[model samples]
Target: MIDLHGFGNQLLQGAVITVELAFASLIVGLILGLLGASAKLSSIKALQWIANAYTTIIRGIPELLTVLIIYFGATSVLMSVASLFGYEEYIEIGPFVAGVTALGLTFGAYATEVFRGALQSIPKGQHEAAVALGMGNVRKFYRIILPQVWRMALPGLGNLFLVLLKDTALVSVVGLDDIMRKASIAVSSTKEPFLFYSAAACMYLILTIISMVAVHYMEKKASRGIKRT
Candidate 1:
């Protein structure tokens, strides 16, 4: 065993950052995914085309490439603006922002398809009934469509979230000091790669277990009062 008492805190801190990144990305991703799905479902041809392209291109790209592109692209753009403003030094966007944006974009791409399919899975009769009962478009969507879509999308979203949690490890490539990067550092210092990596694995396993419990609770809550088909 390594001297975990003294040197383990760094790893713990990194793991915390990792979890925070995952949750933050998931939230942003969820919002973007819903918006993208709505755009895809819209009657506007251009909006639907744009949204479809976004999903297809993003889903096709490797996660690592996407992260690097977002990370470097964002910084480069900011730095350009800063230089024009007579600030010779670069305006820094930290690892957290880069990691969150990258991971969020990646998650959103997959989520767009999931949400679109879920929304489509809802019975058209529900919308028709709501309209017949004098519900406007907004009311119908919120009261009828949203509820059903959530129920249908929950499983797919949960699966995406689980994958998103694991992908937080990739942020380590950009020096985010997440669990994997910290584990690598620890291994270097202690010359115990297996021990540190195993610890990291344990942390990931714990996260998945907790997520499972939460997802199950949410599923039951969302499906409440709905009868079997």
Candidate 2:
């Protein structure tokens, strides 16, 4: 057993923070993905353009750069807006919030494409059938469309989440006490860079494995009605 040398508790705390950051970003990403997909599918050209621009721009940027921009740039923008309002106090975004926002935006851009593709995969004939049956829009979506969409989108979404989980390490750059940061701290204290970094890598791998198992279970549940041909 490679001794953690009293850094075990702090590393565990960092792991907890990592989990929180990942889940928070996941929630934000899911909401944005849904909205983006809806906008892309809308008849309005403006909405489609806006959604397209958002996904394109965010996806184009580097993830670490995105975190830095959201963290520092947001503070600048917030401070500027506050100055306009005569509230000249310094504005700040916490490390956790910054991490979640950056990771969420990146995750959302990809998830938007995932959801859009999934929605498109659902046949138009099904929608026509639902309409012919006199089903309301909401009823049709809930009863006929959403379940299939979820089944189709879940795998891609799961993969995105795995990426997002890893990206939480980027938050450490912004001073969030996540696993990577904790490992850095341990290294600084113990002068054992290899041990701490190796530990962090194992922790990340453990998280990935757990997420994969959960995704597999969910996939099974979502595929309940499909005949295995």
Candidate 3:
């Protein structure tokens, strides 16, 4: 049994924070993906242009850069906006908030393409059939189209979530006390870089394994009614 030098609890707490960060980012990304896919598929050229620009710019950059930019830039932006409302003082964005925003944006960019492809893969006949049944666009989408889209998008979204789970380490650079950051601290105190870092690696591996199982279950549930060829 390798000793953690009493830092095991700290690491566990950090792991909890990592899980929270990933889930928060996932929710944000899912919402953005839905909106982005809708915009891309909409008849409005302006919406298409905006969505295209968002995915293009976000996907082109590195995730670390996105985190750094949001972490530092958000504070400045908030300060400027606050000044307009007659508030004086530094409005600092927390590292967790910045982490979520950055990761969510990156995830959403990739998920936009996933969702777009899924939406396109859906047959047009369904839409026509819904129209024939006098279903409004909103009702038709919620009742008929969205379920199929969710089923189709689940695999891609699950993969993206696994990536996001690992990417939570990037938040450590912004001073978030995630697993990486906690391990760094432990290494510094115990001068056991190899041990602590190895422990951190195991933590991440455990997280990935758990996430994989969850994703597999979700995919299974989502595909329940569909017949596989």
TM-score of each: 0.90, 0.93, 0.94
For model 2, residues 1-229, the per-residue Cα lDDT tens digits are 3459989888888999999999999999998998899999999999999999999999998999999999989888888989999999877699999899999999999999999999999988999999999999999989999899999999999999999999999999989999999999999989999989999999999999999999999999999989877
Error of 2 at 42 (Å): 1.4
lDDT, candidate 1, residue 117? 96
Off by over 4 Å in 1: 1-5, 78-91
Once model 1 is optimally superposed onto the true structure by TM-score, how far is the C-alpha of residue 216 displaced, in angstroms? Answer: 1.1
Which of the numbered candidates is closest to the native, going by highest lDDT? 2
Q: Number of the top candidate by TM-score?
A: 3
Q: Candidates sorted by lDDT, descending order? A: 2, 3, 1
Q: What is candidate 2's CA lDDT for residue 184?
A: 98
Residue-level lDDT tens digits of model 3 in 88-154: 9877689999999999999999999999999999898988999999999899989998888999999
Question: Scored by Cα lDDT, where does model 2 land?
Answer: 0.94
* Model 1, span 25-100: residue lDDT tens: 9999999899999999999999999998988888888888878887888888888888888988866767788888
TM-score of 3: 0.94
Clashing pairs for predicted structure model 2, backbone only: none
CA deviation > 4 Å runs, candidate 3? 1-3, 82-90
